[model samples]
Target: MLSKLFSELKRLPRYAILLAALTALGMTAGLYRLYAGLGATTNMSKVFPWGVWISFDLTTVALSGGAFTLAALVYVFHMHDLHAATRPTVLFGLLGYSSVLVILFFDLGRWDRFWHFIVYPNINSALFEVSWCIAIYSIILIYEFSPVIVERFGNNRLLEWIKKLTIPMVIAGITLSSMHQSSLGTLFIVMSPRLHPLWHSMLLPVFFLLSSIPAGISLIIIGSIVSDMLFGHSLSQRVLEKLGWLMPWFLGLYLALKLGELLVTEELGLLFSSGKYSLLFWLELVVGVIVPMILFSIKSVRWNRWGTLTAAMLVAAGIVLNRFDATWFAILPRQGVTYSPHWLELALLVGVASGVLLVFTILSTYFPVFVETMPTRKPQEAAVEAGRAERAPALSGD
Candidate 1:
């Protein structure tokens, strides 16, 4: 009996176990911080009310922005070839928005008063707009995601109801996502005087919206690759190819807009300056943008599976790096200091992420996130089987 139980446990996914452990640790830290108050726990102070949570947690909402981009492509624009990518992206966005709200609650001084935005109604605040948009978008995402559950249960009536509302919900999601994504950039626009010129621009909203394209695509790519690594099912090569084609075009536009803005604003010299800010700025441009663009523009790189994975990782890192520079690094000159997250704060982030991954794992495991069953064979095994076709057939051969 003990042997059978151990066998069952061994069959469980490793990621699920990791998530469970991290989630437990994160929750323990979070609950302690909740009762202990922010003063006793976090490193955040008067000069820096935001730290890693704001940079990492908040930026993740945009990272999850891939849901809307994919929704618009497959649903609104009717790119049916890409439909397989949509459900997973929507699931990702749901978790992302949920995680951001949870992180925001942790960051609050009066966590209980979070609902005050709805009750008091501040029409003038950028945060107010962002709050409303996220709230509405979260609800829409719930509706959008319901079909997954309904379909899993084979509930035709509920599925039909969800289908009727699907188009409207997708449209609403795209609209509200646009609002909050750009509004995130708008939040920093008001801080222009304090923002490093290399990081600040009047076209902040445009950049945010524009960046969302590659951000969303890169994340989907990374997620697709991860799912392949973890489960062996992935989007078809054509769909990924389509996504790869998009990055170079979008990056080209972004590079032009950013470089032109720097040149026109006379901040071009800063690109060559000596400082931590300049160093980070160049890293963001070079590692994140230029390298990915050059690699992706090469047809051989974007079309090859491994090459595509490398390009996607670069794009994801680049977007995250750019957001980080904008949110924390660029503001250092004004604050006259550096900031880092507290251990508890880092724990909360880990916990939040673990929870998100746990939810995704549970849903994907049970639901039809992919229409195809994931292969059980590893990539090397599959390759070997391909080489010895008559002697061995792999799980992915069909």
Candidate 2:
């Protein structure tokens, strides 16, 4: 027994061990932060209450949009072919949101009062709406992912019951996701005075919602590629190409809205004149949006494995930059004060991220999260199996 256990431990990957170590350190840091309070652990203040944690939370939530987008495509739009990618994407989304909730807990100054938002209602507040939506949507994700669990137990009856409610749950999940995704943008609308003009506008909510679609699609594409490489579990290349095909339209729309808003608001000059802000904005737009948009528009690029992966990575990177710019970088720091996340803050963030990856690795390893994309049987074998099945009743009767 001891020898078998040792052999199993020896087979564990070096990276998995590193992730476990980081997660352990992160947990220690998180516990310390809760004991020491935000003042001691974070670099946030009245002027910069939203720091790296908030930026990470927003970015994660945006990327996690894949779960709903894929769900909508499969269940709502009847794109049954895309169902193969839905389970893994949903699991990714669940872990992504789980990390967001953990980071939010650490970011809270009054960590013990985290439940205040639930019991204390504030309909007028955008944050209140976001809180409720994220909370409800997380539950919806669990419900959506429950089938993966029930399947392992061979609980066909329970699975059928869950399947019966699947459509309604998916609809509810989509609705909740849309609400909070837009509401996250609504958060910046109120900060217009403090936020740079390059990023601020009356249509911030619309911009956010539009951008998340491509971001979600990009994440799904990337996740598929990664799973294929790491675990040999993934959707077909043609399916990935189809997903890539959707990117250009959404990216183009986002580009149009962003440029149109700048034109309407007369902030085009700021695109060049705002110094570092201009550079940051263009970094996200050109590399993250425009370049990937042009690449995805090309048939050869979208069809090639590496090409699609590259485009998806760019789009995902762009979303992360856009979220960070809106949440932290673009926000004007008060007079002489500036915010840089403490080392512990970053450590905890790393830990939470690593923890999610670790969990995903374990789940995907044990669960039938990835659909079987490879053929399992040869033609001769299948023919012989069918022949046996055809004669089974006659043989039994004899």
In order of listing, the candidates' clash counts read 0, 0
lDDT of each: 0.81, 0.86
TM-score of each: 0.90, 0.91
Model 1 CA lDDT for position 115 = 94
Candidate 2's residue-wise lDDT over 178-231, tens digit each?
A: 899999999988887899999998888888888888999999888877665455
What is the lDDT, from 0 to 100, of the residue 71 in candidate 2?
Answer: 93
Deviation in Å, model 2, residue 151 alpha carbon = 0.5
lDDT of 1 by residue, 65-148 (tens): 898898999899998888888888889999998999988998888998999999898776778999999999999888888888
Model 1 segments beyond 4 Å from truth?
A: 1-12, 333-336, 372-398
Best by lDDT: 2
